[model samples]
Target: MHWLTLHTSVPMGQQTYETSIQQAVRDLAEPGWDFRASSVGSGRSAATLRIPQRVLDDRRGARLVGAATGLRHDLVHRFDLRVPPARGPHVLTMHDLPPMRFPDEGRLPAWCTEPLPSDVEVICPSDFAASEVTELVGARRVTVIPYGVRPSFRQPAPSSPEDQRALGVSRPFFVHAAGVTRRKNLEGLAEAWAIAAPELPDHELVLLGPPHGRREELFGHLPRVVLAGKVDLDAVGKVMAAAEAVVVPSTYEGFGLPTLEGMAVGTPVVAVDRGATPEVARGNALMTEPDGPSIAEALLAVGRHEIDRDDLVRRGLARAATFAWDTAARAHLDVYRKVTG
Candidate 1:
């Protein structure tokens, strides 16, 4: 079997979901189905970071797309929505419904039209998003497969004093690691942290993220916040290791990857109970309200320095173990098998 993973949607200058996506495919794709992918455009400026997205933007039409499904595994999945998989039996995966343009217009875009392909089966990242798919686009064919995390064993608790010092805490700090996006609700986090900071001056707030648009406005006024922007995974793991809890205040998420990452590092999470978060948190997290006051109260718990570190880590590790690229990959491979021989 040959896999046709249409990757025409890779961003010109960014890594995007390449790491996990590749890992998932490697772990899941059906045996004998050598995976093959092609981009509609050269995306020539990609290396230079000047990658133009014009070609991708113009592919919203219901064009009769054609492509080879590389082998016994001639099944392809159109991951990039730019070009619909109209050529073969495809397992179309949509990251989100950000591009649907139709009678409802998503009630937003005007020029675009929904390309309802005849030979494609759509797979959504989450049920929350899947509901939108079926509701708006009249998409009858859809499946919900949540993304999986890399499971790992829990590291020994703070046995090394040096490790404790490096994380900048004898006690424990709260961590908020992710890109600074509007949807991330970092502004609310900042306010919540601020309100809680006074009550619990002992616990530090270490923010780990790259500055996205409006970041300056987001954290410009924030104080006592350690901005470890753009840290590597090792650094993130170390930071997660050092924290008392991880915070996620996203207004929405297709899949909360960071929450799972935090859990893998043996850090318990406190997240807004919204979108795929509750599902991702899976009862291991200390749920928090999205509002500033409510979030402040949760932070107060961190600031008061009263959490059972071992217990939280133990539960987090247990929860994290449930999600693994291997398991996730296997699940995806099953999907491929169902589609092809």
Candidate 2:
């Protein structure tokens, strides 16, 4: 059967929607399926990478193979004119339509996404995402299939005091590894952390992602901020395992995968009540306003042991278990089967 895989426009080497989709493809291979693929986004990190030049050129061509028909073509977050995917059965995965409202740094082309029917099935990763799709493109085309977490993220049985000390985590700490983006609202989170930092002087802040230029004033003043940039999945797991909690401070999200990942590692999560975050992290996390006091209070509550770790862990595992790459892949396979049937 012929299958068209759309690689995410996300940065290369980093795990994002594209990475999750690729994993689903790999896992789907275990089942009975042989299919070809194509995508518009460049998963490559740098065009200057050592890979052959022909491969790079082929990447763009392969994704656009069916674009002429106006479907399954190049899609962006904004309301752009795009060729729609050919008629028949097809599955389109939308992480979120962020660019249309609050755009990223890049300027979008004239054609971002093509028009499709309400009955067309579009896969989303969270309830909020599904709702948003319905709000934007209508309900018939939407389904909520969260990206699955790799099973390796279970907390390492709660490291002992000595072990925690060795990892440089002697006291309770919170991890915030959001990329430097406007939507991430790192500055707002930093403002909150700054307020709480003094009360809990010993508390640590493991800032795993890079610094955003726009929020220089807020992120600049923070002391004892551990900037762990571009960490691998394994290392991230370790980091999350050690944290008292993980904070997702984004103003919006298509799927708050990290919140679930943190919970998968048995770390309690605190997130703002916004966008798909509420859906993805619903039962497993502590939702709060984006203000400083709210963040501080949420962090403090989790730190003070007011939140039941066992319950959080149990609920998190259950919620997280709902999403499996195999499940996602199987759903895609069904679509393909119907497409080819």
Candidate 3:
């Protein structure tokens, strides 16, 4: 069977979508399948379709092969729903409906909101995202496929003290690796931290990603809160490994990867119960209401050892173990078989 993979044109970075796609595509190998891949956007070149045997043979690490050319294929799998579907069998992984939900922040053109072609099938990372695709995007066929944690996160080496010092952050810190977006609820988290910081004098709140001008102004003066800036996944895993807990205050998410990452890294997670977080966390997290008081209370509880941290870590690791890239890739292949048949 021959197929084409369509990816969104995103700059190489630590964005969840980009990273998840890379992970998913790498494991999408099947014995009988012929793959050709290209990107939809113009920003960066298309994603690597096939890896060279030499690259895979490299003991040090794997390098991405060049983008494949040509569109002639039996099926086409798209990673973005924003682009129009091609003729014939097609599958799209709609990560989230940010444009439909938060119109002001992520408004899309009207064409993108139109119902997908009958030949198209949509895949979501969570049931919540599936519902959004059905209700808002008017997709007729949708599937939910949760993402997997990288092995690096599952059995991670601890980030040394020097690494922590380099980031200008210390232990007993609560890490929030999500970016500073409106849906991420950084302001709500800041407000909660302001209320809880005084009590947990030794604990610091580490905000990942690049600092936002407006959002930073609100919480920059807060005590013991470190804006660690954007770091790679390795650094993130290290910080998470050394953290007291991973704080996910986001009110909206397609799927809460940070919560799972924290769990995989054997750290407890303190997250607000909103969007797809509850679905992803599945009672493994210290879930709180989407408000300042509740978030602050959860933070305090984790920092002070008021909750059963060991239990949370145990349950989280167990749950995270079930989500594997191989399984997800097989599921994708199943969908492909169904659609092509």
Taking all chains together, each candidate's TM-score versus the true structure is 0.79, 0.78, 0.88
Q: What is the per-residue lDDT of model 1 for residues 1-341, given as tens digits with 9 covering 90 to 100?
A: 76656555342111234446556777554456676655454356333212244533444432333332233346766665544344556676665553342232122223224645444577766787677666655566777776655322234243255754654445457888766545677878988977887777666777766655456576667665665566555456666766777888876666677777777787778888887778777777777878888888877765565677568768877887776656556656777777665
Model 2 residue 190 CA deviation (Å) reads 1.3
Least accurate stretch of 10 residues (summed lDDT) in model 1?
Answer: 102-111
For model 1, the stretches where C-alpha displacement exceeds 4 angstroms are 8-18, 24-30, 39-44, 47-53, 59-73, 83-86, 98-115, 151-171, 306-309
Best by TM-score: 3
* C-alpha lDDT of all candidate models, in order: 0.62, 0.63, 0.75
- Model 3 residue-pair collision total: 0
Model 1 — TM-score against the truth? 0.79
What local lDDT does model 2 show for residue 165? 58
Q: Could you tell me how far off, in angstroms, the CA of residue 201 lies in candidate 2 after the best superposition?
A: 1.2
Clashing residue pairs in candidate 2, if any? 70-83, 70-84, 71-83, 71-84, 71-85, 72-85, 80-112, 81-111, 120-141, 122-141
| Candidate 3: tens digits of C-alpha lDDT, residues 88-113 | 67788887787676644554545566
Top model number, lDDT: 3
- The full ranking of all candidates by lDDT, starting with the best, is 3, 2, 1
lDDT of 2 by residue, 226-278 (tens): 55455565567777887888898888787877787877787788899998877
The model with the greater TM-score, 1 or 3, is 3
Candidate 1 lDDT (Cα, 0 to 1): 0.62
Question: Which runs of model 3 end up more than 4 angstroms from their true locations?
Answer: 10-29, 43-70
For model 1, state the Cα shift of residue 123 in Å: 2.4
